[model samples]
Target: MPQHTPDHPTRQILTLDTGVDAVEPGPDQRWSTWPSIAKGQRGPHPHPDWVVTAAAALDTELGVLKTGKEADVFLVERAVPDDPDRAVLLAAKRYRDTDHRQFHRAGTYTEGRRERRSRDQRATQDRHSAWGRSVRATQWADAEFATLCALWEAGAPVPYPVQIDGTELLLEFVGHVDDAGAAVAAPRLAQTRPDTDLLADWFEQVRSAMGVLARLGWAHGDLSPYNVLADGERLVVIDLPQVVDLVANPFGAELLHRDCRNMGAWFAARGLEVDVDALFAEVFAQAW
Candidate 1:
C-alpha cells in the first residue's frame, strides 16, 4: 500500500468528512423529491464536502464539468502530471436524499430493479434507526465504485475508478470537462445532427460497444439516447450504474439482448434497416 501522507503529492484526493450533526432521527424535506430517494435520506448534501475531498485527494481543484439530477462531475488533476494523459477526473456522486411523501420514484424509474431494491431497503432501514443512514451511505458508495471498476476492467469506455471513500468517488474524467470548444455533449442518437458518414460511424461505435459488453460478460441494462456521449470521432457510453454481469445472472442474457436491441432500435428509429434479431444473436453467441 502506498503510504499517502498529508503533504504527499497524491494527497490531493480529499476525504468526505462532512460533519453529520443531526443526532435526532429525522428527514430533510426541502430536497426530498423522490418517492424512495430519501427514504433513508439523512443529513445535508455531502457532495460539496465530497467534491472538496475528491479534489484534495486527487491533488487538483476540479472545475465543475456538469450537474445532473443525482450527481456532479468534475475534471480533477492527476497526482503525477509527467504524462499529459496522466491526470484523473473526478465524478463525485453527490448523494441525494430526495425522498419525500409527494412523489413515487419507485414507480417512475424501472431501469435498475436491483438498485431500486437497494434504495428501498436503505430507505426502510433509514426510517427505523440512525444506523440506517450509515447503511444507506455505504451502499451508494459501494454500488457506484463497484460498477465503475467493473467497466474499466472490462474495457468499457468509462471513467476509471481510483478509489471510493465515504460519499466521494475519484476516477478518470471524461472529455475536457464539457467546455465550449472541448465539450462533447452527449449526442442523443435520436437528435444527433450527423451526416450519413457520421451515422455509419455511430452505428459502428454502438456495435463495438456491444462487443465490449459481450466480451466483458455484462450489458448496459438501460442503453438509450441519454447514455451515449459523442466524444468527437468516438461515441462513449456513460451512466451505466445498472450494467449487469451476464455470467453471474441468468437474466443477464436477456439484458444483453435488450441492450443490443435498444441500440438497434435507436438506429431503426432513424430509418435505418437494423435487424435487431441478428444483432442480438451475434452479440450473445460466445465465439470468443
Candidate 2:
C-alpha cells in the first residue's frame, strides 16, 4: 500500500520505477497519452479516399452521442498518430440488441427489397432459427449502408459513410468543436429555434434534400424533425434504416406525403409559410 496525500486522498498515486528519481507526475500525465486532434483538414465534404484511410486507424471511443430504439450512436476519435491533419471525429452507430429494436415493422419497409440467395431469404423469414435472427440484424445494417452510399453519391448533404463492420457503421460527425475544445453534437431540428429568415433558409435546405430523395424515387420512411440534424446553417438528413423505394413499394406515396407533412408542420409551427401538400406535389413531380 502507498501513502495517501491528505489533499487528494481518493485518487490512486502510483510510484513508477525509472532510472532517475521518482517524481509526482503532472495532472494530465495520468490521462491518456494519445494526441488530441486539434482540427481536421478534411473540409466539409471529405473524399472517400481520406475517410477510408482514417477509419482504418481509429483509436478511441469518446463517448455515447445518442440512444434510439433501433440503434445507439457513439462519438469516436480516429487518427494517425503524430498527424493532426489526418485525424477526425466520427459517429460510430452500433445497431445492437435486436431484441429491443422495433424490428416487427421490418416487413413494411422491406416489402420491395429482396435477398440475392433464396436460402438467405428463407433464413431471414424463419424467426425461430439462430441464422434467421443474424440475417435480420445484418439486413438492417446493410440497408442503411447502401442507402447512405446511394444518397451521398447523388450529392445530398449527409454524413459521409466511412465504413461498415458487421452491425457497426462509421460516419462523418455532423457538428463542430465547442469553445471548451469538446466535441458538440449537432442539435436535431426539433430542438432548434431559428429566426424567421433563418427558418425559411432551413426549410429550403431540407426541401432541397427532400427533393434529392424524391428525384431518386426514394422515401425516407421515418422522416421527422427528430432525425434531421441542424449543423449551424445546414440541415443534414439522417436515420435512413427504413428508406423505401417509391416505384417498388406499395405504400411509397403515403410515406412521402407523411415526410412532407412532418417537416411542413415543424416549419409551420415556427411561423414559416409552408404548404405540406404543395411541397409533396413539387417533390413528386421530379420522381421517376
Candidate 3:
C-alpha cells in the first residue's frame, strides 16, 4: 500500500507506484461552473471586465453572507490559478429546493406572471407533484436574474447580475475590501446611522431608484430597509424576485405603496420628514 499525505483538510489524494494519479478538490474550491452551463444561461452580452469566464477558472466559496427563507447568499471568488488579476468576488444566491423553501407570498407576487410553457405552467400549479416543486424552485431564481439584467440596463441602482445557473445566481459583489483584506458585505440601510445630509442623499437615491422602477411600470414588491445595501454613499437594491408589474398585477399599486411607506418610515425615524403619501403619489404618477 502507498502512503499519502493530505495537503489540506478538504483535499484528498490517491497515490500509486507510478505517481499521484487522482486528487479531489478542497471543500471550498470547485471547477468553474461557467463552462458547463449553456451560453443562454449566461449574463447579458458585454459582460463586465471583472466577470471571470475562463474555462480554467476555479470558484472558491468564501462563506455565507446571508440566509433567507427562499435562498442563501454565499461569497464566491472566481479566478484562474496563478492569475491574480483575473479574480473577482461574486455573491452567489442559491435558492432552496421546494422542500426547504418557504415562499409564502409567491402566489401574490406571481399573479401577473406566467410560465411560457403550458407544461411548466401546469406543473407549477400542482404543488404536490415533484415536477411542480422543482419548477417552483427554479422559477424565483430565473425571475430575479431576468429582473436584475433589465434593471441594470435601465440604469437602476442594482447589483450587476453576472449569470444564473439553475437556482444559483451569481451577482457582482457590492462592497469594498476591508482593512483586513477580506470581503465585507455592505451594511443594510436599516443598520446605518447617518448624518442628516447623508440620510437625505440616501433618500434621494432610494427615490430615484423607485422612480426608475415605476417608469418601467414595475415595483420592488418587497422593498424595505433590510433589502437595501448602503455601500459608502451608494445605495444598491437587492432581493427583487418579487418585482411587481404595476399595470398587470392587481395588487401592484398596493405593494408599491407599501414599499414607499416601509422606507419612508425608516427615514422618518432618523429625523428625515418623509411624506409617505406624497412619495407614493409621485412614484405612481410615473407608471403611465
Scored by lDDT, the top model is 3
Overall local distance difference test of candidate 3: 0.84
Q: What is the C-alpha RMSD of each candidate to the true structure, in Å?
A: 11.2, 13.2, 10.8
What is candidate 1's TM-score against the reference?
0.58
lDDT (10s digit) by residue, model 3, range 1-288 = 843321111111111111111243467778889999988788766676678898877788888999998999998887776666667888999999988887787878888888889999999989799899889989999999988887877778888888889899999887767566677788999999999999999999999999989998899999999999998888999999999999989999999999999999999999999999999999999999
- TM-score top scorer: 3
lDDT of 1 by residue, 223-261 (tens): 876778765555767766456666666567777777777
Error of 3 at 247 (Å): 1.1
lDDT of 2 by residue, 45-115 (tens): 33444343532333456689999878899977655444555556678888965677855677777778888
Q: What C-alpha lDDT do the candidate models reach, one value each?
A: 0.52, 0.73, 0.84
Compute the lDDT of residue 10 as modeled in candidate 1.
21
Candidate 2 backbone collisions, by pair: none
List where candidate 1 sits over 4 angstroms from the true fold.
1-70, 74-90, 97-127, 177-191, 247-251
TM-score per candidate, in order? 0.58, 0.81, 0.90
